[model samples]
Target: MLNKKVLSCAFEKTINIEWHKGQFTTNNFLHILIHELGHIFYFYDWETFKINHIFYLKQFLGHKINNLNKFSELDKEKVLKIFANSNYGLSDDDELLAEGFAYWLLTKQSMQTKIWEFWNEYFTSYLPQIRDKERKEV
Candidate 1:
């Protein structure tokens, strides 16, 4: 069985500590892990090792990089910069695909703690703004 305390502690170590406090349950952690794992599985299918490796290299070299398990608000800013400069914002196709895949994976299982609900809300708010910039660039 999953431990709510341990899961909440892990969440606290990340960016959403205060905001997500008392918000996440054990089931929430399972959903998050499964969501991330979905992204990993998708990348494998999409032959994204090249770009993913580059991303990891930049991360290891101390560049501000955000992967599924490790996204901070700063990474969100970087994505905004990418949206300002490129069609996809700062997110590459792989990242976008991963996000979608995560949502899909969440649907394949029972969701607890309303984590999927929060994720959907976040995507609904952010994706359009990013996409609006892309549309204007066209």
Candidate 2:
């Protein structure tokens, strides 16, 4: 062991230093990975993906998004800008499905619990393929 203390951690493409303190967590990373795999599932199942997308799009656009995550304060203006500006999610059917899948996986929602149920069932049926795809993609 050296005299100097450990300064940072790196996991795959994500680097964590003092600057990124509290910005994310292990659960968040898994959620994001799950989100991307959700996109792949959407590609395989277009009809169900479309239905979920339209439903969530209406739900989110109809009201202000208040509790999307834990790290940020809620604000309609900022959230809308983020929805419009993000590279993925919030702007299209596929992205919406992916984000919704991740949200459901991460947070156990009681209301409209069907979304989580659907993914859970879907993943159960396709576990091996899902794990393989996620490993390759990330």
Candidate 3:
């Protein structure tokens, strides 16, 4: 029964990516940052530490191989899919963690963020395997 604000506080403790105003408006770009922040909080949650380590390793290597911006939608989806679908991905845990955090931000009046209309379309495609009941319930 953790409140969204409580989850947000827990999530912010680990990830420190500064929000870039310019990128904030972009669809997948924002989700990318949110997803990485999820990993930070996932590590905070103490579930799958070594696997999260490997997830980052694969992300680093994938970025190196693709030479794409880490924030790029394609690049980010690659990382999210790999992390959320691998042994770590099996739980659908990361998606819930990330979406929970993002959902909090979306709900807070001070956050000044709209529910970017296209996010669902884009994220749903990347999240083919994981289902987010909370998102629907919200």
Candidate 4:
């Protein structure tokens, strides 16, 4: 089996926005940043996540990902839907999670409580290291 820590995730960092009245704002960019941060949060915590919560993640996601390459399109989507909050998030599992987390952080209300708890644990446990790492780099 592929190691969960070796699996990849993609994310956006910066975005370009057109300036217009009553349109997008810095808050929109903050949401995108929050989504990207969720991906980083997972990246930095992959080992612990795999060791402790892989089964829960798979179960909560509602599809077996061990053979993702062989999944039928419909089957793939069934799993992805649990994390995707928008059509844009339907690309794959990672986006589903990132986008779903963005919505979760903003609303704080959803049926995705399992994922929320996972993220909460991740952040609770890792925030200190993350802050220290960035602080040292600065």
Would you estimate the TM-scores of all the predictions? Answer: 0.32, 0.36, 0.27, 0.44
Residue 10 Cα positional deviation in candidate 3, in Å, after optimal superposition? 30
Please give the lDDT score at residue 58 for candidate 3: 42
**If the candidates were sorted by their TM-score against the true structure, best first, what order would they fall in?**
4, 2, 1, 3
Put down candidate 2 lDDT per residue, 55-136, tens digits, no spaces: 3333453343345543343343344334321234545667656765675567655554644554454445444454455556
Q: Give per-residue CA lDDT, model 3, range 1-138, as digits (tens).
A: 977667666655333232232322223444545656866765653442233433443444454445555456656656544423123233465554465445444534555332322233233442322224323533
**Alpha carbon deviation, residue 80, candidate 3 (Å):** 21
Better of 1 and 2 by lDDT: 2
TM-score of 4: 0.44
Q: What is the C-alpha RMSD of each candidate to the true structure, in Å?
A: 14.0, 12.0, 12.9, 13.5
Question: Over 4 Å off in model 2, which ranges?
Answer: 1-27, 47-87, 109-138
Instruction: Give the per-residue lDDT of model 4 (tens digit) for 1-138.
Output: 644233322212223322132122222555766778867655554543332223334443443246764667677556646555555566555555566557667654655576566555444554445545655655
Cα error, residue 134 of model 3, in Å, equals 26
The alpha-carbon lDDT assigned to residue 81 of candidate 3 equals 47
TM-score of model number 3: 0.27
* Candidate 1 lDDT for residue 40: 78
- Name model 1 segments beyond 4 Å from true: 1-4, 13-27, 47-90, 108-138
Give the lDDT of residue 28 in candidate 1: 51
